[model samples]
Target chain A: MPTVRINDENVTFNEGATVVDAVAQTTGRELTAEGKPADGGRLGVAVALAEEVVPRSRWAGVELSEGDQLEIVTAVQGG
Target chain B: MADMSLPPLQIGGYSLESRLIMGTGGITDLAALEAALVQSGTTLTTVAMRRYSPETKTSVFSMLERLGIDVLPNTAGCYTVRDTLLTAELAREALETDLIKVEVIADEHTLLPDVIETLEATEQLAERGFTPLVYTTDDPAAARRLESAGAAAVMPLGSPIGTGLGILNPHNIELICSRASVPVVLDAGIGTASEAAAAIELGCDAVLVASAVTRAQDPTAMAEGMRLAVEAGFHSARAGRIPKRQHALASSPMEGRIDLT
Candidate 1:
């Protein structure tokens, strides 16, 4: 089991876990997990791993390694 | 009439026709951006990556290219060196240009560049052969350091990114100009034509703005005003200023004058 660090918080994942999956599991917030209220539903999440922007669709295919830093950014609307 | 010769300014090996560098964001559309660019007479325009849709190639790049203007791609939303570098690489590939507008923002509220991360990204980009146009704060020392680190130009913010507060620190901007060997372009917080003019008058080589022109009531008209303001600022800078005098000098012969009855 390889460990991953996201924004300095450490999390464990099974072998061959994608960066997106690891983030969703660690945060308890569904990235692709949809169907909630408009204000409370998960809008979208953008992942930046090792300083490269990985598109949402490609996040599932991206293989993660130990010591890889990831940034999971979610968008929120404001007036 | 007087001689109208002015020295030319070079940036990233390109001879700029004007010191006003426009941004491609916040416009109604590509047509409006083109019109504004034409009216401003700026050779370079900043384009952000986040605004681009990867799904569709329909973008302002082709439009700006058709207008015969140079594109300076910006890393507007990047907060780290790695993100900035990646964005720069992507921009280079997409735009087919090595010129980059590097913005490492630590705080979204202030839109201020993270000096440490910005310098780090700058060093990496410079090593990798990217001409980084850094958007920094109005700090003279930081501007000098950026120039020393191989920045194509130092773009200090007049205030925040879109507040249009104008030049909050003219003295610091002047200091940056006096210290740096590269061009000093005022990057943000410019709300009107006068702010652009003031930046140029403070010895900045150029002004990079978006909302001021694109979000105005009439984009084309505001663009024209910005053009004239930049021109006026350039002329004023070249014309120099009247030296301040501490004591008054007698215009007439006051010491030898006779009293009248």
Candidate 2:
């Protein structure tokens, strides 16, 4: 089992799981059983793992490794 | 009723009721973007196209259409004339609009527009019957050249994109606004409502901003602030400012009637 850190929270995952799956599991998001975020998850926010922006759809293909930093940035509208 | 006598801003014969322009890149979600757009009271919205994805179909475009916003597709990542032209053509076909936000960057690090390439692409796009809104630097000479080349509007970056440093050079922006015949929009590098207001106060025709509102702690509130800032800036500009003098004013009655002395 390989472990990854998301926003400083450590979570262990199966070897081949993508970063998205890891987040879905850790955050108890609906990606595991239910396909989507119920109403098209938060916008303007992106998940950056290893300094590269990972599209929402590509979360499945992105494999995780030990000590990878996953950052989730959500949009907050202000002037 | 509040004074509603503000004249509509004309760009290529299109009268935009609102002076604020929103960028589609930084919204938390399409839904949020929609909410902010409504709150901002802006009719024009900008979207960028580079690496086309089939999956993006029906979601992004459809949502924008549902909001009834006029889309201004941009050549955000193009660095050359060929790519810019192709992207503009594709955007026209896909977005069904002849309006293009032309941004030709020479360096990815700073995201500064390549002046020569930008002019070349602008000339071509204008000749092709597309309304070109060129994003450029705050050089008066460059802005004048773009105007002569027939740019519909000239957008000068307040600073680098997404840094939110606000207006770095107010004098240069003022220079551009004063010299250009076309609409002058202060684009990029705006971090807050104050920055937007400052640009408008400097007599810019409009302000195009994204990350400031979309990346804020509360996007909807920030959008409203931006709206107010533009209005305030416009009003301030119209009201005219008093001249600043280096010497102190003689208000203390040096020789005048001072009964309490």
Task: Find the candidate with the highest lDDT and give its number.
Answer: 2
Q: B27-74, model 1: which lDDT tens digit per residue?
A: 556677678889988788887654212232334655666678777878
Best prediction by TM-score? 2
Docking class of 1: incorrect
- B227, model 2: CA deviation in Å? 0.2
Which residue pairs collide, candidate 1?
A: none
After the best TM-score superposition of candidate 1, give how far the Cα of residue B179 lies from its true spot, in angstroms. Answer: 0.9
True contacts kept of 2: 0.00
Candidate 2, residue B146: CA error in Å? 0.8
Docking class of 2: incorrect
What tens-digit string does per-residue lDDT give for candidate 2 at B1-261? 777555778888567778899887766476787888889988888877533222342355556667777777888878999878877775665455788889999988998999899999999999999999999998889999998887999999999899999989999999999988999999999999999999999979999988988888888899999999999999989999989999988767567565775
Location of the lowest summed lDDT over 10 successive residues in candidate 1 chain A: A33-42
**Candidate 1 residue-wise lDDT at B79:** 92
